[model samples]
Target: MSGDVRLEARGAAEETFVDTVHDLLDVLFERGSVGDDDQMLFRLAVSEVATNIVEHAQSREPIEIDFALTCDAEQLCAVFTDNADPALIDLENVGMPDADAESGRGLAIALAALDELTRRTEDGNTWILRRRRQPAA
Candidate 1:
């Protein structure tokens, strides 16, 4: 019950990006031995990340992102690699935005839901999200 699910979305709109992630998550949950709580939380984190990437990406050309999800007996992980310009994000400063804020809560929510979330921008932008699996009741 452990393998990988991958998808590539190019120039996708925010809605499309979320839909693509939903499709990938459907496949992952179906194939992996993930508990219901784990599946729900992971889905939320993944959707937030996908929406953030689609909404904030800056480039003259269409955006290109390679997304991968992997699961094993003990954990689940996701990686996102994108061709857009590197994003300057301060993860340490991420926090829930004000109540009136229309945006800015995605990273905070994602970070709170997952065991680990990291971003790298050396060659290109890469985001890694991981969570430890919970035992089924």
Candidate 2:
């Protein structure tokens, strides 16, 4: 996609965001903007991040969030901006938990599928995830 596909919501459930990501990726796929492998990886990372935000962000009221995705020949990117408490985890040190663990795998999974995953909290919490596209053979 030349521009970005955007969604803005307040206190949306994880499923909503995840579904939106899938739908957006479908559009990109139909447009020949990304390959199947890229779409699958980006969907996985976005779903994990959306679930993490909905489950972990502490807020007495509904959290407002802006989610956007973009794709080009070289890469795909997703950005999430939330009006919730700053996420306090170390993005650089996100590690997968033990296999038996039920939680704590979201960030790790996202990191593995992404070339760049970062979080900033200057004006609310902003998360950016990027994955480089593979060369077409």
Query: Which window of ten consecutive residues has the lowest lDDT sum in model 2?
Result: 4-13
Report model 1's TM-score to 2 decimal places: 0.89
Report the Cα lDDT for residue 1, model 1. 58
lDDT of 2 by residue, 24-128 (tens): 667656664667788788889988898788778776667777777777677788888887888898987889999999888989999999999999997678999
- What is candidate 1's lDDT per residue for 5-41, written digit by digit as tens? 4444444545676787788788888888688999989
* Prediction 2 global C-alpha lDDT: 0.78
lDDT of candidates 1 onward, in order = 0.83, 0.78
Clashing pairs in 1: none
